[model samples]
Target: MRVLCATALALAAVVVPALTAQAEQPVNLGSTQIVDTVGALGGQEAEVESALNRLYNATGAQLFVVYVATFDGVAADESWATATAEQNGLGTDDVLLAVATEERIYDIFYPSDFQLDTEATREVENEFLPLLSDENWAGAALAAADGYREAIEGPGFPWGFVLGVLVVGAVVIGIVLVIGRRRASARHTAELADLTKLEQRASRALVHLDDSLTTSEQELGFAVAQFGTEASAPFVEALEAARTKVGEAFRIKQTLDDGVPETDEQARAGLLRILELCDQADDELDRQADAFDELRALEQAAPQTLVQVRADAERAAARLSAAIEALRLLEQRYSSAAVATVEDNTEQAEMLLTFVGRTASQAEGAIAAGKSGSAAIQLRTVQASVAQAGQLLDAIDSLGDRLAEATQSLDAVVADTRHDLAAAKAFQAEATSAELSAGIAAAEASLAVAESPSTLANPVARLERLTAANQELEGTFGRTRDAHTRIQNARVALDGTLATARGQIVAAGDFITTRRGGVGETARTRLAEANRRLDQAVSLAGDDPVAALAEAQQANSLAGAAISAAQSDLTSYQPVGPSRGMFTGPGVSEAVVGGIIGALIGGRGGGFGGGFGGGRSRSGCFGALGGFGGSSRSSGGSLGRSIGRSVGRSAGRSSRGRF
Candidate 1:
């Protein structure tokens, strides 16, 4: 019975994973001609879709255009496009063009029985590649459509085949060939310029990685000395892996630098490889550095941290009575729903403060007994508890202020919303659509609710409802608005969106900062990207409020994602058992090592440096926001840096090449 059960379990495990994989396969757009998931075509999606549909009707050969972020972890662009085509039951009569905007790569897929000849296919790709390289996404889609149509229709009868016409045509052809040669020369020059820039970038990345590795090595030595070899094994392993990557990067650079001729493609590939290696090395080093920093802080800064935690706890405890009083007052003035978020905040604060106190005492005992690892863990717990307690107390204290602000802003917002609704109604009166009518109705309902006396008790909720409704109305009629008016509206919306994005980013940063022990690269990367986007939003707010609004929204999304990723990481974190032969344990050793290395490296902050935003440059801390460039960084693939491929089953014939 045991053998039978074991066999069944094994089979189930294999089958379950297979089923899951199958279920997760990428979905194909059966009839949709344009899939702009990344919004790369902006508002021109309809225009592009129309062109593609026209081409399909004209030639009976559908051309599916897809734009995505980064192929969603797919390794090959062609494979992904081919898989989609196969899934859609497409064959020689159809083509799929998949573009990953973030990765800056694209592929064209068709079946073996594809209608177009090889030259025609090449011509179609040529038509769009230049536009794509220029980031003219809409233009590229249109160009592709036109190119396919032209290929299918072919040139009309040679009317210039008469004697005199043929002579004129010959001269024209000669002139065209000369112009083409000149253009080709210009293109070659441009390509070389781009390659040179990539080469320089690769060199800079290599230097940065090399410097990081050196600092990490020194830190690793200190860690080993303090914690012993066994405890510092992870860092050692990470350092070695980083070194290996650096070595490969250097080798590639050497080959490129050697006094030997190489093709432009070859050199570009080498440079991209160097950058990829550096990126990978940096990621590995950053992860280990974060862990090391946490370990070091607990061991070396335990006393100070413990004191801080205790101080915070005392302050939170002191505020508990005031918080309770505030909540009581709010409850009298507001409904249960309005005060519910903070009703139990005071009690929770009190309990957390008590836990902090107990943890602090245990941590002190552990510190005194030279059990630094245990002390560090206990100190971290105390810190977290104190922080939570402070948050709870603050929520109680801030609720009334928040409500007051919402109430104060509600009247003005309501006025603006009414004005917007008037404009929407005027537009709807001109030519009413179901979408516009629905939006107008929703706005009216939301406005009515916002003005209700009962809803006044929850001013924040009312404000949110009104804001959302107004936004929907604006979206519905935005295209009809004059450019100036649209910009004015966007300016009004941008401020609130920016504020919300900033708050979310700060909250996520705080969470990750406090509980970084379990946080991984994904959270850090998202946080960095959020900061970068926020910065961009701020910069663009004056001139391009609409773009700024979009950027702010993206920043808010990224921040939320960061928080989610961090929470997941923390949830999955598993503590390792204590290692032998250390002063306090592995934790203490890591702290010591981190401190020494940080100092040796002149306390240069870790994690992507200030390239993200104007964040602090703290050693081993999530400081300098801009260094990693997050999703902005070029992820090297077959087409070189910043290029990506899609992952999908190999089911159709396709040609993959770089733009």
Candidate 2:
């Protein structure tokens, strides 16, 4: 009686506590439709995914955990273990999930590097994050899961049937097929595994597309924010481009939404490709945005380049103003600079009229005081001012006659100035040449005294020594020895020449800057322009960036034209025809081949001396002498001069280019 009583008490003890706990805690009873992943361990076959779903139904066990695997028949199978979570209405490895149990919460993830247990029979229970506080299941969390599963079904999937089952689980998993979302009278969806596989593939693709769209939105917003105002035009274009792509993506997404519409693997692949295009468009839109920003920056820099040009123009204007001031001083001597500037320079010839009507006798006796210069000076000065005012002006050069007369009075002064300039230039040139020669002499002297090829300052001798070294090296060292020696010699020679040429060139530049004065300025301007053009040509000619020759040609044309115009000096000289290369005598055509063949006494290639005789010979000989055929006179070398002379002669009769 005592033993039986003790056993009874212990049993009662266990039973009472179990009842108490069961009363306080909630049970997460899941739909029997889903299987238990841990059923082999005596766990419940139906594991509650959401604590709220169980509590709402009021038939669940506490400590709800979603089954990584659901038992198809109250037990896990090898085939079911390997099956994707989506195939069983569970979450994919990549999906994020939230679930609540009686006492805890979980989050589930599938990183790329994740490894699944192949050997352990226990199904992987992915943890989902909780969205609840109560032990009893919240209805909201279950509602969320229902919508989430619908999202995987896509608009085109049999979502209505799937939702019906998730709603009450007694909308039997089998019944889900019997009354499809679109199967109005057809009774049920096809539940074949093959069809399910196709559905899963489409679901995965849609998921990827959704994710990419979210990324696109974020990236595009970021890019637009970065652009600022200067990017308005390009930003608009890029936005339009992206919008078009997004529309295309929507079409593809719609196709995907027609869930599992494909009948075969090929169709699946095609659908995947469509998704890929969407991804690609997304990437390209972002890339194009970057390019657009760069282009905008380039446009902004253009204004800066223009500003540089304006600054250069202002400098040129300043120089021109200075030259005009000097001209004002020169004109001040004759008449009121203001009046003479307004009068016809030759109207000062009216002053000459005063002289002419008076008499040579009166003119000869006129002025002795303050007349240090010739009378012609005063006459020319007056004439120049008058002519400039356009009263009696003919041509700018017309003033040359009066100018000569005036300058003749200053012959001694000009002579003295010219003498000084010539003397300075001579000394400058001599000193430059002397310094250069002295360096060369020293090098040569050193070269002459060297005995050994290796020790010599002469590069060729050094090279020779290197060659000997290479010859002696013979085995593996030969080529290396020769290369080293040659490099050393070449390096030495290059250094010497560069050092000696450096100072002479520098000194010559000094003289150019000092003596040439404004000419240096003009030359510097022209050279700089030329260099810029050359650089532009190189930039244009770039293989990927631009083309080389075309850039070079454009650069050359710009620089050449500028230099040619600068040479004509429109600010000083009257307009002249564009300068051509050295002018020379006119051309006579000659066929070199014809003349040579004629000398060989062979064929017409030698002209008249060749085997061909009579008319052919005469024609050949004449053609050879003309150096051309078809009466197309050769004119390249002497063309410029010939044209100049002809034009000048014609100008004597009519308006044309003279010099």
**Highest-scoring model, TM-score:** 1
Give per-model TM-scores. Answer: 0.35, 0.15
Total clashing pairs for each candidate: 11, 48
Off by over 4 Å in 1: 1-264, 279-305, 328-348, 372-377, 412-444, 455-457, 467-659
Give the Å shift of residue 349 in candidate 1: 3.6
Which candidate number would show the highest lDDT if scored against the true structure? 1
lDDT of 1 by residue, 409-447 (tens): 999889988998888888667655687788889989989
Error of 1 at 376 (Å): 4.3
Q: What is the overall TM-score of model 1 with all chains considered together?
A: 0.35
Question: Model 1, residue 66: displacement in angstroms?
Answer: 35
